[model samples]
Structure formats: C-alpha cells, structure tokens
Target: MHSVNTRTLDLNLLVVFATLWDTQNVTRAGERLALSQPAVSHALRRLRERLDDELFVIGRHSLVPTARAMELIGPVREALGRLDDVLQGSTAFSPATAQRKFRIASGDFVEFLILPRLIQHIASEAPGVMIEVVPLPANNALPSLLENGEIDLVISTPVAFGAGLREETVTKVSLLTLIWQREGLSPGRFPLDLYLERPQVMIEMHQREGNIIDASLRAQGLARRVGVLVQNFMAMPVIASQTGYICNLPGPIAQAFAQTFGLSCHQPPIDFPEPELFAYWHARFDADPGLKWLRERIKECANTSDE
Candidate 1:
C-alpha cells in the first residue's frame, strides 16, 4: 500500500467522497454538495488518483463503492463530524435565521409529549430549522448511534448507555392508568382489585422480561393479566377505549390520550416508579451551539408540558 501525502490532499475531496458514499449517484451527490455533476466527477477523479484506488464504479443505477471506499467511509465520516463540531463550537447559532436539520431518536411517547410544543416554538423562533425524529434503536445501539454522528440527540426513558455519552434528566413523570369513560371508573385512584381483574393493554417496547409495573406487582405477589401486548404507546389508548382494557402510561401522554379519545385518567393502584425522560448525546459534540440551544428548547417544552 502506498502512503498518500496529507499536505497535498484537498479536504474538500473528502467531503465529496463522503457525500458520494451517502448518495451513490454522482448527480445526487453533486446536488447535496451544491456542486455540478462535472465538478463532482472531477473531484472523484482527483481522489482516485491521489488514493490510487477506484473508489467507486458505475453500477446499474448508482455508483457502487469499492471495498476500499467502504473501508474509508467510516473514518472519513468520523473525521468530518469532528471538524464540523469544532467549527460549530466557534460559530454563533442564531436559531432565528439558522438553517440546519437536527436528527433525533425517540419513542412515540416523547413525540406526543414534547414535539408539539417544540415544533410550535421552532415555527415562531427558528423558521429555517428542521427537525427529524426517528424511532429509537435497540438499547445497545444508542451509544454507537450518537458517537458515529448518526443522530444528534436521543430522548428516552432512563436506560444504561455506554461510555463517552452524556445524559440529563429532562423530566420525571408518574404513571397514570387509562380506562374508558364508559367503564364508569371513578375520577380518583383506580381500585387494586378491579385493576388486577380487568384485562390490561400493555406497552412492551422491548422484549425484556417485565417492566417496572410488573416488577412492583410481583413484589406484592400479584400480576395483572396482559390481554393485549403492543410495541407502541400510541396504540394503547385506542385499544383501551374499544376493548375496555386498562393501560398504564406516563402522566402527560395518558392525559393527552384521555382527552383525545374521551377516556379517563386515574392513579395506578400499585406503587409505580416515576420514570425520568433523559436526553442523551455524545460527549464529542458537547460544545456545539446548535445542539446546546436545542437541549434548552427541549427542556423548556418538557417544563411546560403539564401546564
């Protein structure tokens, strides 16, 4: 292998390389980089000569990356991300005029609770900014997602994250039991006997053994019958309203669903733990002004959610 001289390499070529890797088509890559297709091709040609490898070849519909290009992408992305963070740290982030997109990973519960207020705020204060929210990956993949710059932030219930990640408790919320108004459930605390007797609609996001509610019930030598198991919190309200099943959800979400679906919210019969929603990010981008502003905005939304 021939070692390439870094002094002669143009940093913009790496940018083109990374963008080309993301978008296999040269035309699409050129559009993303705001360069003409010919310019992109010229840069790719220069990069191929400098690296002495055919980094990409024309495929049926797109440019397929050679094995060498595949091996180079990860480190290139990491380096570019680090450089961007450094530049962003030195620049002032004026949300009012800044045109940037933040990618966030979160569950639907966060979407229902925090996003409305955040979007409204952005519309008035940061009209040029964009927000993209994606579903949270598996528990183990979160750290890598943040470290690799795949996601800008994560909003989720408290979970163990790997090293080099920073976490802050955005809000703490207690569980509320949701029941159909037609069931004639009282306005106060739900009865323990009735809670156990009624079939429950459980939100099981992961395939874990049991949730906090189940653990508390087991401590009391009791277990509620899970009549229907679901992977999303959005489904719980509809299921409970139609089937008369009980679902325990976070306070804000429970209230929101109850109001939307004309259900009732009551305190859970068991002693349920108040789960804290956390915002997770990689330590590498700790000084990024845009991300810092975003975190503050999220905290503000969470603080006002109950109000």
Candidate 2:
C-alpha cells in the first residue's frame, strides 16, 4: 500500500471509476465516457496505482469490482452525481418531471401558513418532487446541519448564522392576538389593559422558559399574564378555543385558526416587531438550480400574509 497525495490525483480517474462501476464492461464504460477502450484502461490503471489496489479485474464478459472498489463506489457515485448537478446548472431545473427531495427546517407557524398550498402546488405541478419538513428547534437544534448538507434550507426569524450562510426574506408576518369568540374581547382590536388582565396561552417557539412576546412586553415595561404554555402555534387555537385563553400568534396562523375554531383575531395594542421569516441556506448552495427552484416555490407559498 502507498500513501497517495489526493492533491496530485486526477479527478478524471474517479469519473473513470464511476463509469466503469456502472457499466462493468471496459468497452461500454469507454463509450459512456466518450473515451476509447485504451484510454479507459489507462485511467483505470492510474486509479488502481494511486489507490494501491486492483480496483477491478477482467471477468468473462464484465469487469468485477474488487472489495476496495466496492467500498469506494458509493462516495464516488455521490460525488459524480453532485458534480453532474453542478455542471447541468439551473437550466436542468424542470420541476414537472424532476424527482428530487428538499429538506426544510421551520416551525409549525410557518408550516401551518404555507404547507397546504405548497404541497398542493407540488403535487399538481411537480408530482415527482418531495418536500420534507425538518422540524424545529431543528434550525437551532442542529447547529451545523445546514453547513454539513443535512438540510437544504431554514425558514425562521433572522437568526445569527455566522458565516458561509445566506438568508433571503421569505415573508414578514405581523403578530396577532388570538382569543375565543366567547372571551367577548372586542373584535378587530385588543385593548392593552384587557390584554394584560386576560389569562394568556403562549406558544413556546424556543426552548427557553419565556417567549418572545414576554420579552417584547418586558421591553415596553409591561407584562401579560400567561396562564398556559403550548409548544407550537397549532396547539394554541385548541387550548384557547376550549379554555377561553388569549394567545398571541402569527397573523396567518391566527387567521386559519379563526376560520376553523371560531376564534377571534385582534391586533395587539402594544407595539411589537413583525417577525420576518427568512429562507437560509449555505453559501455553497447559493447558485444551486434545484435549491433556487425550491426557494422560489417556498417564497410563493410563504406569501400568504395579508399584511
């Protein structure tokens, strides 16, 4: 065995290896790679020498991969696939017939607002494409998930991602106060005094003991009485509906909940910053055609806010 410096290795050899791995026959592999049979043999020879292994051997009708070649094939194939994707560019993004999977990280608020429309659009137009929602706390939970290629995008309030990350505004969503119609709060508006006095149901987006709403309220030298705490925005309506508790939820989620659970939506009296949901990705994927297409679809779906 020899210690080969990868810096001096020809990447073309991996292509030869990949082509040979797929086709098995030297002639077929050479035809696929647009190389003569001799050129393919030469490339394989170099690859074998560099790796200090007989990567493949001539069988009756096909080349048999050595145990070492079998071990390297998976990563070699993956690398070549990624390289092909890169070389193909945005022109190859045909959602209609493309079979691809996208991983997105976001909370229930964003999911509740956009998933149905997004899913329907994908199902109707890009039947073969798939969307996987990597649940949050996911964005914060896995610090290196995006950088390591574990997830494609992050949809969240502009959080600090240090470097090699890019964020694009998906949508800005204003906060709305949600209360049961039975609570008898005035429609269209919630008075600050009544809001402070009412028992509130809080959605804990972060794992912290307190919520952003409480932090905002404290900044204004005021506090609301939170009587219950739920994990996601979806549960807020359920708790508020049955318990007559007021909850501060995103406008889109509140609107959906209002229609479904007979809840009332009111503009909060206190001044609060609207949460801008941003689509974040690693800088490496900034020019990726597939992710670009996915991002556009996400933006379309996220553009649900009336405000």
Candidate whose lDDT is highest = 1
* Model 2 pairs in collision: none
What lDDT tens digits, residue by residue, belong to model 2 across residues 26-78?
89988988999999989988888889999998898788889998788756755
Q: What are the models' TM-scores?
A: 0.74, 0.70
lDDT of 1 by residue, 244-296 (tens): 89988888888877978878999989678888889999887777889999999
TM-score for candidate 2, residues paired by index: 0.70
lDDT of each: 0.87, 0.79
Q: Can you give the lDDT of residue 158 in candidate 2?
A: 70
By summed lDDT, the worst window of 10 consecutive residues in model 2 runs over: 136-145
* RMSD, one per candidate, in order: 4.6, 9.4
Candidate 2 residue runs with Cα over 4 Å from true position: 1-90, 137-143, 206-212, 305-307
